[model samples]
Target: MEELDFFKSPDEFPPRRGGYGLVHVDCVGKRGYTNSALVNLYAKLGLHRYNWLEGTNFELDSIMKFNMRGAASPYYITLVACLPSSGLQQIFQVLVEEERLGILDLTCPISRPQGTESSKKESTPFLRPHSEPVSATHQDRLLGWTKSVIPWPSSEIGFSDTKRFYMLNESELQCDWISLYVELAICTSHRWFKARDLSNFELEIVQVAIESLHDKEPPSLKSKAAVIYIAYKDLAKARTGEPYHYQAVVRRVINEATGTLSIQGDCWIAAAATA
Candidate 1:
């Protein structure tokens, strides 16, 4: 599933040598100063991750107030997201630390954010996160052997099936996991921060597959859950950026020892590499 920083505080203390200082930015009003497109992207991405893991469908309606503090790389963003399903909203905070294409800290989208005194308490999140009890395993298998990987499993609560790979029905591909995968497929494929020309181009993914060793009882080695995604980089947003297909192996960091179903970023966008 897709999930979700640091910046200096405009309202806080001064920075020291080799040190990061917590920031407190002053907002104009209840809406805060978080109207940037990138900030909006982060809010949506975090909600996407939350939906899959919690088994709830909370769409982002709008962004309320937010506080940020960081220089460039790892930015700590605390934002309140309004859900369309319910007028209420949920407050989320995260840490971002990736160079090329990045997501928030693995430990982010913190179930509850600090100072939860929003106009809409936990109305958005409180009504969601309804995952059924699972014995163990991932609903979406990251292990490869197939040309496509079903975003979520229908029958099994967990991916504890003895078989290494399982097939998914066409109907089952319409879950939040698919959105998470697609979002990941696009972002993870473009990890070149220095490549300035690639930003405006569009992206497409196909032959998506996954490979993992975390299935069995006690499983095998820990190689981090990986998805072998084939993406097309179109230099033109007209869907003709040279459909160069290559494998994009990506992973999400979760705490296996505790058996938590959510995409815990031990800190988002856990691992990315080209093969």
Candidate 2:
């Protein structure tokens, strides 16, 4: 036989179309052995919490063994943006209820230090100048009301910055007048639905509540509710992409009756005015 070149033989390429070759053998082993083992392990562990996880695992297995050759992994990215506050609150409530029912373990630990600090702070008395004891007198009662109702270390909600406005009343107004206004504001916010909206419905509720307030008798003129002339105006302003504006009044209502409080007549803004 003549000398043949071993390198030139077609068999050197391992017969690309043959059965059970190295490439086929490796692929089959990965799919049947390694990939299957991983899938089985994952299934046994039950780690598929979300739909994305299960889908991702399936894609990964198919790609690794070249069974369904494509991308090496499923690149999935989800972006949730600008969730509404109301929806967020509902979700939080659901989670809390679930935890309460023992559907899920509590993820957060209770902090004893914070609890202790709060308790200690509560025990300390607030030292305000001329802090007279609260009494049946209008002044004392008003002071007492402010201290008890208003949260200490007040934020924007407290209207603490407007404490001067409250104090300025001392020159010309009585404590009952101030107290009644504060009480009305606080109670309406606490009792009514969508109180923050201050819409027509809220205004009606507030009016009714204020009318009810006038039924009570105060010891002095200073203690009476201020006669307020409420005027709702559209200054055409938007806060955080929401159409809102200065819903205002000409004066604060202190003492009033079922009949409307008269301001310079032009001061009152009713639905008719808005229309």
Candidate 3:
């Protein structure tokens, strides 16, 4: 009904009693999603990702209908989309994950909706459906890992379980977008960046480690089941461009029942000693 942005806190939303209306359950199974705003946004996101990966422009025509299942963030959605080029509407299943930082990770799988047999025969000028399991080699192809070189004592090698801060050398930090997520996290409603206090943050991310097992983590970080610790060297150019080392603590809250995710960030910044 109103303009929507990624900034809204999902947890704060007052629960709706029912969906817009009960739609027919043909093949895709899920409760109807009432948010018309999200209906357009999520559908576009799904199509955007699909077009990017498949190199096909099956333009979004209108938000016909939407259904959300799993009751959480990474929702499996089925919607109708038509190609502006041909006005042929097709059903597609999309996976959309709402991140804590208000970012979305939407993906489209390779499948023809509404009975693959019939749709395959009816749908015209197909893309040949070059499908591959993304999860099968997702890490091997896109992500690179180095394994943290931080040498801890053998006794402190790792927690009895992965319940404590374990070294993570996940090198996804080199990308500009991942760096942007960290940048947004640094502005966590704190006044530190106001009045030109700590602007021009140039970060050289040094390490990415994760900690679990709530009991051993900080009280604030313990709010979530797991934590991602981003260690980096920063330059506050608004000042003297002086370098400072800080570890920003990122907390992710996941609703296990619905598999929805919410994230918050915090950091304790201390300047590097005078050179």
The true-versus-predicted C-alpha distance at residue 190 of model 2, in Å, is 13
- Best-matching candidate per TM-score: 1
Where does candidate 3 stray beyond 4 Å? 1-163, 175-181, 190-201, 214-224, 236-243, 271-275
Ranking by lDDT: 3, 1, 2
Cα lDDT of model 3 by residue, 1-275, tens digit: 53321122333344556632223222233333244334444455556545544556665554433334333344345667777787788876554554322222222222234333322222232334433212221111111211122222244463344445555445555633334336545543331343133234577887665564245443222233445666676665425754476656554433322222334454545333332
Error of 2 at 10 (Å): 73
- Candidate 2, residues 1-275, lDDT tens digits: the string is 33321112223334434522212112223324322332222221121111112121211112112111111211111111112333321100000000111011111111111112222222222111122222322211122122223222233533233322222323433322222232233232232223222222222112211111122432223223322222222332232343332122212221111111111101122334345
Candidate 1 residues 1-275, lDDT tens each? 21112222443444457654444544325442432444444555556545545545666544443455443333355556555666666666543333333432222323334453322322234323343333345532233312223233333443444254432334443344434444444443333322233235343333333335355423212223433222333325334443343333334443333222222111112122122
> What are the models' TM-scores?
0.48, 0.17, 0.34
Superposed model 2: Cα runs more than 4 Å off: 1-124, 133-232, 237-275
In candidate 3, the residue pairs with backbone N, CA or C atoms under 3 Å apart (3 or more residues apart, or in different chains) clash, namely 100-263, 163-212
lDDT of model 2 at position 229: 22
Candidate 1 deviant stretches above 4 angstroms: 1-38, 63-72, 99-162, 176-207, 217-241, 244-247, 256-275
